[model samples]
Target: MNWKIWKKKNDHKKKKTKTREWVDAIVFAVVAATIIRVFFIEAYTIPSGSMEKSLLIGDFLFVSKVNYGARIPMTPLAFPFAHHTMPLTGTKAYWDGIQWKYHRLPGLSEIKRNDVVVFNLPVGDTVALENQEPSYYNLIRQSDWKTVNSQYTITSRPVDKRENIIKRCIGIPGDVVSMKSGIMSINGKIDPLKNTGQMPYKIKLTTGNVNFEVFSNLGFKVSEMQQLDGETYLANATSEMIQKLKPLDFVKSVELYVESPSTNDGDLFPLDPKRKWNVDNFGPVKIPAKGWTVKIDSNTMPLYYRAIRTYEGNKVEQKAGAWYINDKVATNYTFKMNYYWMMGDNRHNSTDSRYWGFVPEDHVVGKALFIWMSFDSEGSFLHKIRWGRLFRGIH
Candidate 1:
């Protein structure tokens, strides 16, 4: 064998054009990033003030898939990095032609109570392309299905491709959850997260013309404060903020704004006029766990109907005063998947499980770990970065 000639030939074969090298490097980077995002961890941002005070609107968080198990992508054919829609084009980013059944890779732990969790929006199966803020169902409730359908472009999304939402898990499987006067009680015990959560408060001032700057210094956004009367204003604030404003000289009284249990403003979960469940006062309804069986009746149907029919994928119908699931008379129902009750830390401002009902286990995405970066849009150029919130662990 000619050793020198053989070595030179091999070396020449190994050498690549600049364009080929760049293409190989780019492909490798994209594959590596996608794997890490799907199986390990991914970045998320607080787009709304729903988790205010605990997790701010500008905080960028690294949600951990290992904490509650990484949910296998149901819609596997997707553009890398884009969530639901393509950037600039505003077109569908994922192909729903191929979908896998719900499966999760084993993780360090199951989702626990009070854990900040990210999950697919349960009611987000249908969405209005033009106006997505109120949700498709909510828009229908406000007007009617016919009106909303005519008003905007409507589309249905698969389980994983639906909008991703982050909230605190108030009730885990088999837990009884309720609320009274804007305070939540889980299993008949008051929620401990209430102390850290924010709600609307009626703040009365001693003088009609008081400086709003004082409230701003106390971390209350001026836009969130609404004047109710001459000397009274309604503001969304945390318990800590309420405490700080109480002893102020110009303050008359700072009281929590609790809605009356009797108030039937409608636009709640179940949407039953008879139930009269408001945001401030609702149920002792139990969160369904896997294999949990319950007798199906007219009363219980209102609560679990959506879960059984939609989340669990059953063909449910009522005929001749008899309940039928999958065309079979169903006097009793057994849940196939565990359900969770999720609520925002900004209790008053959030649209959560209180409105849409239970979130199935399959919708679970990841657990929020910490804020890797925080930017304040309301701050000045030099103070735009929230330095203290950077690298802060999420509760």
Candidate 2:
């Protein structure tokens, strides 16, 4: 046996040490790939026509991950259980906060207004407090099975998810938004929509709720009324937006606010706040103050941040829940982060803040700088090329 082993060792030496080089190559490849995925580029595909014209169905693009800070997992504090560990073992350790590396955004400046960006979905997030004597199984059982028609109806999206969506940002923090005749306004200013070689037509400026459709991601329907231009914004215009744009005596008409809302000019208002009106209306309210103080009584809390904070995020502990703000916890609420309002350029088609309100600070993804490629799939893959939009920077 010893003679055989010696012979095998001598044979291996003669064969050369190519195995070590192969191992090193693999390690280097993995490290390089991880860096690219984490800090540089991310590939995403359009999920639907909701963002039609700008980002079409089947369109694919590379979104730069480092446009915002990269969330690295192997930071110094990531030691101990740096990789994996025995599940449920009390001996295991992990970092609850970002350790070693200082938390900071490394790429571009602050997220700007009118930048088509992506972020985490702020739909249903909540926390709960259990009773001292509560049984563990009961809590689990309650979560598993619940009343059928409750307001917090938990539903699931289909397994195949859309990779990414591209839309133009119209509003930002502290913008007073309202719509008239389907026109969009930010901070009392309406977007000055010029015919950037897009189809141009004369739009009527009527008062009150007039139903029209522009491109939008969310399918929004209704709204209330406020005055502008000469038209009254039909806040609840969903049921009222005439499915057909029949030049009716009663139905008001809206203009094309953006051939493309991604332009720098879109950031500026279309008309003076004192002049125009439209329902695809928006803004007149300030974005929620990040780190600002406030009271959370049952009353005011429901307006400003209530629908988004407690309503959208965790436990609605109706426990005479008089929450405190900052160092002052009473019946008041305070903001721990800033809030932003976003809308799609396709006003009539998009269901954004009007139905699903407020995008939080942490959810900011990246400023859409350019469209490396764009595709529109009317039928099959071979015919999906949208050649006109390729290599175009996000206006």
Candidate 3:
């Protein structure tokens, strides 16, 4: 063979066009950003006052996936940036045809109590597209199932596609959690994290001519305080704020508003007549952990039926006064996954585990790191940005 023949047929390569170069750069950027979001860290914005004070509405923070491990997407096929629904189009952003098993990467540390976490709403599996705020279950509970179904378009979401909510993990796996008089107790002891949270207090003032400025100075928002009547008001305040308020002469008394256990809050978790648990007085229920077993009985069925039948994917039924799971006459259940109890720092205002029950392990997203930016919507133009909260580490 001639030596010239061995030479490259085309040594001169064609240069990329300006349009081609821009397209290539855009594609690379999207892929890199998606990878970073999926396996590293992701940005989240606080949309509600549920986590007030600890995490206020308009607070933008970064959630660290590596802290509690990043979950591999169960619904792998989806639009790059959109979550669940596509923007403007009002259509699905994901294809659930190719669903994958839940899997998580190795994490730096296991989730701990009081660690602020982002998790998928456990009750968000089924949703009425028209009314999603109260949740589909709540809608049915509020009215008849037929009425809800006839009025709104009903849809079901996979574990990963459900709505994401941020809250403090108050009860870890196997912890017996309960709330008495709005005071949460873990394993019969008062919650150590209670001080970090705030609740609605009935404030009896000496005069109706309240100095709203004084309360505002103690970090109370005008919107957060409601005047019930003359000389009485309901205010959401923290323990520290309550301490400071006690010294003020105008404050006759500031009493914590605890719901009586006897009062049947129709919206309470489990929704069982036997369990009259309310937000202020909830379970001594044990959180399910992987490999943990519990005796299946009438007493426990109401509390755990959802976990076994819904979250864990088991066919459960009761016949002849005996329980059957997956067509087997079973008297006990060994959980396949761990579960957690999450509650907002804004204890009285939040619809959390007290309303929906345990958050399964697969629902966990990540730990909130810090506030990168916080916006005050009602602030004056010059003071709009909450400068003090910028880059503040979340406790």
What's the TM-score of each model vs. the native?
Answer: 0.91, 0.54, 0.92
| Model 2 CA deviation exceeding 4 Å by range | 1-23, 71-103, 124-166, 192-283, 295-299, 304-331, 379-383
lDDT of 2: 0.46
Off by over 4 Å in 1: 1-14, 127-155
lDDT of each: 0.87, 0.46, 0.86
Error of 1 at 145 (Å): 15
Q: Candidate 2, 57: how far from true, in Å? A: 1.9
lDDT for 228 in candidate 2 is 41
Please write out the lDDT profile of model 1 over residues 135-215, one tens digit for every residue. 677664554211134467756788888888899999999999999998889899997556568899999999998889989
Question: Candidate 3: misplaced stretches above 4 Å?
Answer: 1-7, 127-155
Tens-place lDDT per residue, model 2, 61-117, is 666667666534333332221222334663324443442422344765556666667
| Candidate RMSDs in order | 3.8, 12.8, 3.7
For all candidates, what are the clash counts?
Answer: 0, 62, 0
